[model samples]
Target: MMEYSDFKFKKMQSQLQEYFDDYFSKEDFLFTLDCDIEDVWNLYLDSFPDEIKGIYHEKPWHDCQRCHLWFKTMANVVMIDDDYKIRTLFDFKTIPEYQDVFRALDEFLKTKRVENLFLHDKHSVGVFRSFAEYDGGFDENHHFYLDLPEKFYEDTENLASELGDALTQRQLFEDTLNLISPDAVDTVLELVHSNSLYRSIQWKDTLEGLKDVFEEFSQLDSNCDLNNWLWKKSANLPRNITHIKNTSMGTLLLDITGGMDLEQAVTNYEKITAPTNYQRPKAIYTAEMLEDAKSKIAELGYMDSLERRFAKLEDISINNVLFANRDVRTTLGEGIFDKLRKNVSRKVYNFDEVSEISLDEFITNVLPHAQEISLHMYPSLKNNFVSLIAPLNEDAPSMFQWDNPYSWTYENNITDSLMKERVKEMGGDVDVDLRFSIQWNDGEWDRNDLDAHSTEPDGNEIFFSRMKSKRTGGWLDVDIIHPEKGKTSVENIQYKHKENMIEGEYLFRVHQYTYRGGDNGFKAEIEFDDTIFSFDYPYKLSNKEYVDVAKVELKDGNFTLTSICDNKVHYLDHAVHWNVALGDFVPVSLICYSPNFWNDNEFGNKHIFFMLKDCINDTNPSGWFNEYLNNELRPHRKVMEAMSSMMRVEDTENQLSGVGFSLGKLGMNKITVKVKTNNIQRIWNVII
Candidate 1:
């Protein structure tokens, strides 16, 4: 009941700062249940104890037997949060048929053979199911009644807290000892924790541990000032600490920061300072002297209660490791990882086994808590090792692990380019390959639910929701539905070659709908036939700034980029579309797919006329546009074939021969063609 919202929580954490390095509240509580009387009968055959498992087989035919929750004890442990509340009682649900089952079991157990326990002899009482059925059979789950108390864990915590308060007061009472001589307390803790010789052990047992300090302090002159010898752990202490010193290289008193037996510490000091006026010592300090001094210190008001507090915390552990020592905390070694994995898989019957799912799925389920399981990291580093605390709540799985890191996943290993090439090599055609890779700092990308929406020219949007745009030959070939769940990966959206693909303006854009945090980024590459266009948007890829990647126009047969991101018109060397008027009559749209790759390397001695239809309304289509048009601005035969297809004309087997071609408009955006067709002069306008 004492939760974080409690008023005294902050004081608790601050008061016990050394005891706890870190602590946090669990989001929810776990369950341990026992369903029925069968569980009780079985537990009776075993030891008559609340704990210690029973050797009885489960009743198979019972309705609740399949659940196997007969008698599982929820770890009945007490926890102290940073707020300093000792939380013992947790909210629990009652089992069904409780009163009837209790009555039946009580009546049945009176005649049954059972071990002799204190008052409750024959019949068992309260089988709090989880802490429920056991040998004792319902003998109150906890010795301490866990009702919602006005100050629930308060009284228990006070035992320790009161001890600390008393100890602090005890230090105040020993003011006479410290005032008389500042070095009145033995500085044993200084030697144990830090080399600085000033204060004694943080515990009340400080004086008891001073026997070893003599040798370490031997180097310092006995006559040195105790002020110089005594050390201060924290500069921000409430009061200035001072040590007593004697002049003329005589005996010195080390500064005492806590309650110390003044008379004994002075005696010990005198022994060390005395030269004996001989070759040895004045008076050898014995273990008896140290013990005598410690006894005097313990006798101080409330210091006795401080001892009980230390006793209470003697067996304290955290993160499954004993933390009783001030110097060290612990982590399980790699040897136990497999053991832990097995225990979670075996012992916890309620949860599905962790090994059943892929490590990615496992990590996916437990993130951002499972962040230590880095997908890209090598397992050799200690920090890289994944630590999974069992999910104690009934509904959640118990464990998760990266069985093998350093290896890539099937989806992760498949890059768009590599997959495309492999598919093509196996006779799978990739008419249009679109791919993009994105990354953010730390693991913020994992929180980002990224989605790309590509709207074709005809207003057909291709997104994760609606994957395929068949009419536009567009397919969300491979998109990352849950980008965070997979490898830091790439997003590829594709479109196969279709007749209407080059109809009008084909605009495809990448939209990042959600950005979790950190620096946003993106890199996309598009491959249309032979040309590959790459775009990099660093730190600018976010929900606010969606990238309008590319716009391809097929007016008069041109699949070219008019503009890219931000709608910035990235003008090309030549206009993308031109008028391919058939016999100077009807205007038709055909693909002029002359990407940069065409002029760069692929076009080797191929003529532009090779692409035109072999028969353009009885005119030699290949030979007609050959000589009169500007071949310098044209692509190879394949491109012209795609272009001529716009007119929907038959392209026969015709060799490249556009003989006697004439360019009419000098520097204009039109190409006038005058070619001898069928022994007649023909003039045509070709828009460039």
Candidate 2:
């Protein structure tokens, strides 16, 4: 056996390169010869250890039968059973680490060879078979030899010198073998020469049948770059390559090209190109631009000053008296009286003399009138100026009260209290007054009485009168005397209708009385009798109480005296008149002033006559009279004609008042009637 020395290592490397060059082209190959013990250890442990193990241990013994079976199974399945005409080696049981190394080298070499084959013979399908099977074991198998070029030998020797002699001969031997690509020699030749090589080749073709039944022993090492060739055409190669080198290869390409293995190269690149902290830049401004802005600002300030001055001058001309007399301040401030004085002074003397008239005197007389006119012309101006000048500390009396022109001073306490009391009374509450007139005349007496009073008189006659005039007719010229004063008397007077047997009484007196003697007093006589007069029924004054039938007689002798006493002889009812047809018996009832028709007999008779005429002459007779008359009289020709004409009905129908009626047959009967006679006449009509 050749001792594993440096010279032997050199020879082995040369042969390995030569074999690789024969099968693979130069551009498609990656050759690495790391002589350092650490580099060689890492390459065996990291990059391609399985290939190294296959080469040494799997070829030496079959002590581990399972490993050998696994290798055989993979080889048979991938080749014979699958009918894949590919070259495969199952030497992993002999040297598993060396098998991984050989696998990696074979893959790299196959890629290169495929490219060369494609370029040379366009019809070539490339290597077609290219995997290495590893079982287990690293130390013995990783040092297997392969053919290499002479330049590889020279490079290996130089690397070993650089690494020094501290490395073991076995390590150097393994590293030298790994440096040589696996595709460098004819796989067929190696298999034929080895003891179990033919069996290995045959097992590779037949492994497919055992694949489903076999337990896979060698797991795919995820740490290896199985798809490194697939990424060659990618645009993101740099980032992807860096990632693969750091995580999978454990070394960078830069360090590897500098004679380091893949793992050490990546570690060194990371150390050299680590990121640094960032710094921020400072801000800067130009002084020239700042100066230019300031200059523009100064120009704007000058323009603003000129504008303010022009505005001040305009204000003086438009608003100051020195510039224009008709300006607001001058005309309003100097007022009408001042203007009048100024005109007088101007016509009489010069401007200097007119200026001598004090502003106080001018404002006192003239400003009041001018303010009145200004209130009518420019009302808002007076308010605006008052509001504007009111806050000023300067004492300008003109501005103090200029806003209100109608303001007047209350001088005396009497008038002030009166006015304030009037306002307070008006504001206190609401009140209403109702007034009515009552007129009557006797034989030698005629009287008209108008009574006016309110519930809330408040002892203020003027106020009551004013309110009363507003409610009733116009202003009353007659003197009014209260019931408390002796000027007017109040008497409880009653009125009764004898025919209706209804009566009512009121507190009656003259509201205003003038001196007229000889029975010129208002008297009301009341009496009650049976057979109530329908038209003369008494209505209640305020409550339901019948008045006494005693006559109330008031005599205006030296003064108006009213008497109210119950004397039956003095009592007389007012006459209630009603009209009836010739043969119709009306069941006569009279509300009259005299029961015996002796005292005041003319007045009673005249009242009855007038009321009868009114009833008979009334064109539109009411329905109440129609029912009474129709029931009392058996319908006669004259009565029917008179009723029809009065009711204004069609001539073909007989109507009483406005209601139609007809007489079917008259019943023959004799009726007797008693009658009363007056001094004028007494008559009776009998119907048979």
Candidate 3:
């Protein structure tokens, strides 16, 4: 192998530079020099022909071609530091093989006694010659110069001394190989046998050394198995023991007595003492013992019976002995023997066919009639059917209508005299019955007298009257009697008496006047019993009573008679009265039919009002009466029907009294109206 010291390596670099400068300029020289050096170094090192190439490769020096080439290549180089300095001038073109010429120079310098030297290249000399022949003059300043300093000799000598030591070491290594031992050879083999510490040792050396040791061992014992020893130490091995023994049998071991062949010995031992087969073992179960088992099972006669009867016996034993309880069976013919037989057989029923029976059949036939069925069947079916149909029947009867009229019986009565006292205690009016009536006859209070009298009447009137007993007539005899003829007429009369006096009356109008779109104004007429009293003067009455008789002719001389206040029109048509001191006012009542009725009037207009218990002074009677008549009269075409539909007054102390309209049922007419209070105030019904 080629060897290099630090000094020889530097000298080689210097010589390579000078050789390049001998034929090229400084710019081209450095560029090509790196490529040439790499090429030569690779050829010297990579092509070295020897099994042992270094201190690591133990082959002799004579067999190493690389060392010879290296020395031959260096023989021509002259060892002068300035001549070999790569940057100095040298005439390389003058010498045919410039590298060979330098090698020769190198060889001569090592032996010769030369001291100071200067190097010049052919290119530098040519440049000087060309300049010397110029017309003006030869300026030597432009030509390349070589100067050898005195210290170059000392440096070259130091470099030579170091190179000499490296050569001496190579020589010492070549002479020591014969002194190694045979047992030491085994130790070396062991060191390389998969030992990580010896990984740096070359594989070629390890294998050759191991082969030599095995050969020596083989000769000592002629019957020894070299192949087995090598196989055991090999990097690769057969996967199974049978294959291992077969491949290395005679070569790995010697049979001295020949009691049995290697294969038979292994087989005999395996058959008698192998892992006990809890059951019979199979021939091809595991790949490692497949070949041995193939012949062994047959030679023992276990194979013939295994195919014919053992497989069937194993399947039946697994089904009966191991898995017998897994299969469910139905019992028939009660007894121990029958149960055992039934348990051996598995049976199942079709549930779809079973569920199709009727309830009676399920209870009578499928349940009680079947011998082997669950006892829970009846109650389970009963619970399911009850869960399905109970709610339907339980909710059915409430769907029918039942009567629930407002009852005046004691159980239903909700009146309170204490509530009336509470209103009075608050300084409020508490009178619950301030009654008034509109009559259409004139007898006692004549219309002509009041219309022509000096007492100018208010536009409305309020009066209080009390009845006096008559001793001449029986209580039942006080019936409807004629007043002054043609004063008033009555129809559909309902009468009732209490304490020798008739207390109530219900009558329809005998005659009514219709005005076509009358202008807004106040007009009123009053009839008491039979008297006709017409009033245009606005007046108010508080406490007064006078009786007179009058007559009115209508419907072709059918005379109507009425009694009234003497020359006093105590009541009037289209008039309103609120008894503030007595807390008596007409109690209006309301009924709604739908949720939307409160949004508009029952007639579908938005006009509405409240009837209160105390009439305020500034109330416009004409306007108030007109609105009441329009809402209560015009819509339903019947005055009684409109009066019945009125919402009842709910009394509050601050609310103004007397009749006025209120917004009625909203989106529908069917709704609930809460009266809420007994002391009268504003009144209206709410729908929805």
Candidate 4:
């Protein structure tokens, strides 16, 4: 049996030698696997023909020949493990089970045809050259094998180091493509090929791709003297880029900047040009301007109804509307102020949405519609609008002029006259150089009792319980424990005479003594050294909670105010707190719609109609009026449609405050209402 196997092995070896001699001719022996020579002999022997014990004249060589041919072509280039499966020389022991190398080979076979592939072994040089010269050895089967050679991996690392060294220029030009212009392209190509980094097999494909991008760019714009432009600009490009991950513009910048981050490089490219210069003109609204606007209204025959709307303006004058000339044109044709209100409500007060309207547009869309404009603007533009308008207006109203100081929240010039006027209105002492006062407003102010407290430089606490501090001679005057239901109430702590004021830090704070109503926040003001500062607590203070409003440092007869409240300093330090309307503060204006005629003579058989008046046209005065409905009233969408239908015609008499069809055979009706634009929840009830 041993002798028979030896004979067969010798025959197999002879056959393989004959095939190699014919294929390679006089070339040196090459293309051997990493396995031992005995393994090759054994592999060939396994495929050798089976001999009949003594009947072996000459067995057919078909199967043996086929196995030998496969070995000479692919098996010589691919390594075989103990199980006889083809694999590359790279060890896969550290990888997870999912990355089985044989499994990868099977997947690669599906898409690619493997010609004479050498896995970059010691014999790869000769094998690679031979295959390049002769291409007719591959079979029709299209089998595949993946060879991850250690030499190629090493080359990748070395190439990265060489590329970094080769790409010496880090500075970038504005126009990256110019660096590789038609005139400079040949020089650039010579530089790339001569650099050992790009000539490597690893960067060969990348170099070709870059050349193609340049060629394509040149073809697109033939008239550009890119060569001359590059010469003048003087730029350097990377020796090789294996991958470009950004925009084409950014990629070229990366090439010029020698591997700067794609996003940062692109941002720099976009900002290469100087920005356009534009200075917005200031918007000024003076008292005379207000009068002129009013005169314009009178000329438009809207003086009577306009005055009625003026009564609802509260702290905002008609000049406020005319000066919001930076009109906002939205998809809904809404005005800018409401958008400002919404933005301020969200603590974002940017005017990017505001756009200027042509004079013709103002005349056509704004001027003639005084009643609609006035009615639409009525109360919502009360406080926060000042924050938006003050910066634009030359004669902007003082922060003191605004009812909601929290809305125009910023440091501003609080003139002495304005302070005196506010002091007189609150009935506080104006003779004193230093005064601290707290005021709060709500529809149910009588129920919410808040007290103001002050700690003087002498450390004496002055509050409602201890109304006077003799050490500092400060009086906690005008304490409103039970405030008037409809009016804003003030509690004052002041040195009655200027001489009584001391030079030291004084702390001002507000204590929520009783909260019988909804969350009602307070506003506090301090005047010292002829300068006044305002602070607002636009947050709910639970019954016993205290807010350290601010601290005043009075040294060398100069006063500096520092707010201790958590609220960040707003854009307009004096603007009313943007979130005030979301709290318990009363709406700037409220209009109640009562049935003009109700057949209440028979209780069960009652029918009532609520009328909507001053309807200049159908669909509720479009523009600002529509904004009021969506933001302020936020009535049921169905109610809006019904009101639009009812108020279709211009009514000279019997103005409509509300609109609803007759209620038949019902004793009562309930309509949902929201008092402020910030509250659109339909949480309030109106009964008729």
Number of the top lDDT candidate: 4
Q: How far is candidate 4 from the true structure (C-alpha RMSD, Å)?
A: 28.8
- The sequence of per-residue lDDT tens digits that candidate 4 reaches over residues 253-371 is 34434654432433353344212211111111223334555554455433332111101112333223332111212212335445444443232222223334433343333332221
The C-alpha stretches of model 1 lying farther than 4 A from their native spots are: 1-447, 481-487, 500-502, 542-545, 556-558, 567-688
Error of 1 at 650 (Å): 52
lDDT of each: 0.31, 0.24, 0.25, 0.39
Which predicted model would earn the best TM-score?
1
Off by over 4 Å in 3: 1-75, 78-161, 181-186, 189-688
The local lDDT score (0 to 100) that residue 593 gets in candidate 3 is 20
Would you estimate the TM-scores of all the predictions?
0.26, 0.13, 0.13, 0.24
lDDT digits (tens) for residues 42-100 of candidate 1? 53233222221321233211122322232222112223222322332221212331223
Query: Weakest 10 consecutive residues, lDDT, candidate 1?
Result: 403-412
Deviation of model 2 at 470, angstroms = 15
lDDT of 2 by residue, 1-688 (tens): 2124223434443454354344432333222221232332333334633443455442432222333332221221111111112222221222332445546533433332111001111222112212334456322322222332232233434554522321232233233223322221122123223311211222232222222111221232454332222221111122322222232212232234345543243335434432121110111112333355345435433212111000111111112121112223342344543555455422112222212223233324322222111111111111111000011111211111122111011111112122122221212110101111122232333322223221211222212245332322222222223222112221211111122211122222223332323233333312112111111112212222222222212222111112333232132231321122332333221111111122322211111100011122122211111121222222222222232223321111111111000112222211222222111212212221
Measured over all alpha carbons after superposition, the RMSD of each candidate to the real structure, in angstroms, is 38.8, 54.4, 53.1, 28.8
1-688: candidate 3 lDDT, tens digit per residue: 2232223333443554465444433221111011232344344344433333354244222223433343333222232121222221222433232344344333333332212122222222111111223357542212112222232223444655634533333232222122233333333233334221111133325335434544544464554333322322221221221122222221112221233443343334334433222111111112223345445434543232111100111111111111111111111112432444444433233332212333223323222112221111111111011000001111221100111100000100111222222222222222211111223223332222111010101111111111222421111111112322343321111111223322222111111122222122112332333222343222322122122222222222222323333343333332322232222222321111211122222433332222222323221111111122222122222222222223122222322222222234434321111122122222122332
> At residue 628, what lDDT does model 2 achieve?
19
